[model samples]
Target chain A: GDSVTQTEGLVTLTKGLPVMLNCTYQTTYSPFLFWYVQHLNEAPKLLLKSSTDNKRTEHQGFYATLHKSSSSFHLQKSSVQLSDSALYFCALSELGSFNKLTFGAGTRLAVCP
Target chain B: GGIITQTPKFLIGQEGQKLTLKCQQNFNHDTMYWYRQDSGKGLRLIYYSITENDLQKGDLSEGYDASREKKSSFSLTVTSAQKNEMAVFLCASSISQFSNERLFFGHGTKLSVL
Candidate 1:
C-alpha cells in the first residue's frame, strides 16, 4: 500500500514571508510526487510535480524537490501572498501506476496582511 | 485549453435514494477519476476509469457505481444515499501513461443526504 503524510494541518504566515509545507510518502515502487492547491470555492489544481529524486520542480513561484533518500517532497515558496491562501495537498503515485494516487491530508495556508 | 464539467453543482437527496453525478472532460484524456472530499478531511478516491468502458475500483468504492460510456464522459451513482451524509464529489481527468502528470479537476458536486 502507498501513503502520503503531511504533518501540517494549518499554516499561517504574513504576506512576503517564506512558506514550507512538509510532505513525506511511503511506496513500494519508484515514486512520483505532486502538489495540488485548492482555493476557496474552487476545484483543486496542480502546482508542481516531480518523479526524479533530488531534482527541484517548480511552477507559479512554488517549488518542490523530490528527495528519495528522505522520501520527501516538500513544497516551498520564497514569498507568500494573500492569493496563495488555500489548501495544499501532497500526492504520490507509484512509478508505473498512474491511476492510483495517494494524497495526504491537506494543509490549509492562510496569509495575513 | 481543456475543461472538466460536472453536472448538478449541488444535490440534496433523501436517505436510501439513488443519486447520480455526471462528469464530462474535454481534455481528451484516457483516464478519469472520482474523489470524495469531506470537511476538514483528505480527498479519497472512489473510482477511476483508464479508458472508455473500463472501470477500476479505488480505495472507497463500496455503495458506488461508475460508468465510462465515452472517453469524454464519466458518471458516478450512489446506490443508496446515507442519512446525514454530506460531502463534495470531485471529478478529475488526466493523460494516461504519464507517471507525474497533473490531474485537472471539475468544480465538484456537493452532496447532502437527509
Candidate 2:
C-alpha cells in the first residue's frame, strides 16, 4: 500500500513571496512522486513529477525534488503570484502498481495582494 | 492530445438511490481510474480498469462497482447513496502500464445526496 502526506491544509502568501508546500510519502515499493494543481473551477492538472531520487524537477516556476531517503517531495517556488492561488495535491504511485495513485489531502494556496 | 470526458458535471440523488457515472477517453489508453475527492480531503481511489473488460477494486471500493465495457469507456455505479454524502468524482486515463505514467483527468462530476 502507498500513502502521501501534505502537512498544510491552507497557505496564504503575499504576491512575490516565496512559497513552499510540504509533501511526504510512504510505500513498500519504489516511489513515483507527483504534484497536481487545480485552478478555481477547473480539473486538477499535473504540475511536476519525478521518480528519480535527489533530482529536482521544475515547471511553471514551481519545483520539487524527490528525496528517496526522506520519502519527501516538497514543492517550492521562488516568487508567488495571484495566479498561483489554487489547490495542490501530492501523490505517489507504487512501482509495481500500475495506474494507481495514492494522494495526500490537498493544500489550498491563497496568494494575496 | 487526448480527452477524458465525464458526463453530467453535477449529480444529485436521494438517499439509497443508485447512481451511475460515466467516463470516456479518446487516448486509447490501457488504464482508466475513478477517484473520489471529498471537500478539502485527499483523492481516494474507488476503482480502475486495466483494459477492456478488466476491473479492479481500489482502497475505497466497498460501496461502488465499475465496468469497462470497451477500451474507451469506464463507468462507476454507487450501489446506494448516503444522505449528506457529497463528493467529487474524477476520471483519469494513462497510456502506459506503469503507475508512474502521467494521468490526464476529466473535470469531475460533483455529487450530492440528500
Candidate 3:
C-alpha cells in the first residue's frame, strides 16, 4: 500500500514571497511522486512528477526533488503570485503497482497580493 | 490531447436513493477510476477498471458499484446515497494498467444528499 502526507491543510503567502508545501510519502516499493494543482472551479491537473531519486523535477515555477531516503517531495517556488492560489495535492504510485495511486489531503495555498 | 468528461456536473439525491455517475474518456486509456473527494479527506478511491468489462474495488468501495461498459466509458453507482457521502466524485483514466501512467481527471461531479 502507498500513502502520501501533506502537512499543511492551508498555506497563505504574500505575493513575491517564496513558498514551500511539504509532502512526504510511505511505500514499501519503488514509488513515483507527483504534484497536482486544482484551481477554483477547475479539474485537477498535473504540475510536476518524478520517480528519479534525488533529482529535481520542475514546472510552472515550482520544483521538487524526490528524496527516497526521506520519502519526501516537497514543492517549492521562489516567488509566489496571486494566480498561484489553488489546491495542491501530493500523490504516490508504486512502480509495478501501475494502477494504484494514492493522494494526500490537499493544501490550499492562498497567495495574497 | 484527450479529455475526460463527467456528466451532470452536479447531482442531488435523497437519502437511500440510488444515484449513478457517468464518465467517458477519449484518451483510449486501458484503465479508468472513480474517486471521492471530500474537504480535508483527499481523494479516496472508489473503484477502477483495467479494461472493458473489468472492475476492481478500491479502499472505499463499500456501498458502491462500478461498470466498465466499454473501453471509453466507466460508470459508478451509489447503492444508497447518504448525507455523509455528499462530496465530489472524480473520474480519471490512465494509459494502461501496466504502465506507471499519470491520471487525467475530469471536472468532478459534485453530489449532494437531501
Each model: TM-score of chain B?
0.97, 0.97, 0.96
Docking category of candidate 1? medium
Error of 1 at B103 (Å): 1.0
| Candidate 3 runs further than 4 Å off | none
TM-score of every prediction relative to native: 0.97, 0.97, 0.97
Q: Which tens-of-lDDT digit does each residue in A68-88 have in candidate 2? A: 999999999999999999999
Candidate 1: lDDT of A102? Answer: 85
* Candidate that beats the other on DockQ, 1 or 2, i.e. the better one: 2
> For model 2, how does the per-residue alpha-carbon lDDT over B27-85 read when each residue is reduced to its tens digit?
99988999999976789989988889999898999999999999999999999999999
User: Which stretch of 10 consecutive residues in model 2 chain A shows the poorest summed lDDT?
Assistant: A93-102
Residue range A35-87, candidate 3, lDDT tens digits: 98999989998899899999988898999999999999999999999999999
Q: DockQ score for model 1, please?
A: 0.65
Task: Give candidate 1's error at residue B40 in angstroms.
Answer: 3.4
Q: With candidate 1 superimposed using the best TM-score fit, by how many Å does residue A69's alpha carbon deviate from the native? A: 1.4
* Cα RMSD, each candidate: 1.1, 1.1, 1.1
**lDDT of each residue in B84-105, candidate 1, tens digit only:** 9999999999998466678899
Off by over 4 Å in 1: none
What do the candidate models score in CA lDDT, each in turn? 0.93, 0.92, 0.92
- State candidate 2's TM-score: 0.97
The native-contact fractions of the candidates, in order shown, are 0.60, 0.89, 0.68
